[model samples]
Target: EAGVVQSPRYKIIEKKQPVAFWCNPISGHNTLYWYRQNLGQGPELLIRYENEEAVDDSQLPKDRFSAERLKGVDSTLKIQPAELGDSAVYLCASSKRTGGQEKLFFGSGTQLSVL
Candidate 1:
């Protein structure tokens, strides 16, 4: 099968602009995740979805960021009124199931630039 797919591989916006990213995970994968990575840092889990339900989102900035996995398949992540500090790479990953040792497949990621 195919790996995860992300659209608009790159985005550039001014501060306070709204931006969105899309992801399509591999078929049969029951768990999906959204992560953000700043320069020189590892990807940080922003949200995790098991099927269509969001299972973990503690690291997500609810005030300006939101995500949704519809029908346990495709997902979208949005950031409204993005700040200059929000410039980073947004990554989408998925796995067959959720577990401590399960391997994850990651998309190339959407690189965001806020000026």
Candidate 2:
């Protein structure tokens, strides 16, 4: 089975600029998740997708950040007019996901730096 895949590996952008990241999760995975990792803090749940439905996304900031899972296989996350504090690792992860458990595997992530 393939692991999660994320693009660009790194990104550098100016404050107030828009940026996006992509992800392709493992084959046959039933659940997918997006997490935001700041410099020294734990990864926070940005979104969780079960098939085509966004099962959990309460923590995602609506004004500037948005995400979608179009086919239930791949997803994208976007931040518009990003802030300096938005510079962080956007990690994509996946799991088989059963019985309310999501033992996940993560990708290398897109490391965005806002300047």
Candidate 3:
């Protein structure tokens, strides 16, 4: 089976510019997650979705970052007027509850550089 596929593995933009990342998760996965990883820190959850509903997004920057899961399959994350601090790796993951446990699959991630 194929794993998640992410587009434009890397991106470079000037400060105050806009950027977007896309992810297509594994088939049949019911839960999706978006995370951000800085240079020296572990990935932090930006958002989580169950189907088309956003179940958790407290960590997402509502002022500039927005995300959506379409039909519970494809997802996109966008940042407008991105700042230099926004440079990092954006990760997309998916999981399904099985036998009382959730197993997650992750994509390679999109690396962003805000100049």
Candidate 4:
């Protein structure tokens, strides 16, 4: 399946500039994440941190995008020298195991428009 479709909401910014998106996950959750949704595609994991340690960040563009989770509660995703193709929605999610299953909670997302 293609997953849920996304809308075109965005935060406009010029090219070759720096922009940052912040997220605060639900309380008591141990996993925090940063994802990027490009147009109609599903959200792609940019970075996943398990209690302040980056466990998965291979999909992230280290040359341009950087992320950090402070105390494993709040997270910031920054992109320097934003490109036009960077226009998309940035999603933040948190997950925790409950009843032998992973429960994920997502944020509304910050959509970016690189001009």
Candidate 5:
């Protein structure tokens, strides 16, 4: 089973520029999540997808961020007009179920460096 896969392990962009990251979840896993980790803070959930349904996205910053899970296997997260403050690791994770108690397996993440 492939662990989780993410692309462009790092990205650099000027403030107000757009950036995107991609993720592919583990095989057979039906629950996927996108998280944001600041400099030293723990990962915070931005969105969660169960199959193709976005079960939760209350934490996502609507001002400049958007996400989607197409076909329920792969996902993309986009930041339009990225901000300097958006520089952080955009992590993708997956679990066996939608239950929050389930353990999550994370990808290395796309570390966005906004200038």
Candidate 6:
């Protein structure tokens, strides 16, 4: 019944610091996604999870970024040694269906500022 939930709506940190974001997808949802949106740009998928398995994560920067969806429910995204370029809105979304035609419900997003 609830929509996607994300914590720490905003975060500010210096470059090289580590940051983490949390997400709780809607109940019964089978698909979850993490996306990054730079200013004036559309959200770009960072990772996508079908239940507990990460089905797509090629866009995620592995060196300093990591994510996990445990128990096919909640998920977390972390960025270590973050750079200024990492400043952006991190969005979490979920869908009940795996088909491409299904609509995704998005959370408010975490706004990160790396100085």
RMSD, candidate 4, Å? 5.5
The candidate that achieves the highest TM-score relative to the unseen native structure:
1
- The count of residue-pair clashes in candidate 6 stands at 0
Model 3: lowest-lDDT 10 consecutive positions: 95-104
What is residue 9's positional error in candidate 1, in angstroms? 0.4
Scored by CA lDDT, what does every candidate get?
Answer: 0.96, 0.91, 0.91, 0.81, 0.93, 0.96
Over 1-115, each residue of candidate 1 has an lDDT whose tens digit, in order, gives 8899998899999999999999999999999999999999999999999999999999999999999987889999999989999999999999999978999999999999999
TM-score of candidate 1 relative to the true fold: 0.98
Against the true structure, what is each candidate's TM-score? 0.98, 0.94, 0.94, 0.86, 0.97, 0.97
Encode model 2's per-residue lDDT on 12-42: one tens digit a residue.
9999999999999999887989999998888
- Range of the 10 consecutive residues with the lowest summed lDDT in candidate 1: 65-74
**RMSD to true structure for each model, in Å:** 0.6, 1.1, 1.8, 5.5, 0.8, 0.7
Better of 2 and 6 by lDDT: 6
For candidate 4, the per-residue lDDT at 29 reads 77
Model 5 lDDT per residue over 14-77, tens place: 9988899999999989999999999999999999999999999999988888999979999999
- The TM-score that candidate 5 achieves is 0.97
Evaluate model 2: give its TM-score.
0.94
lDDT of 6 at 32: 97
Q: List the residue pairs that clash in candidate 2.
A: none
Q: lDDT for model 2, please.
A: 0.91
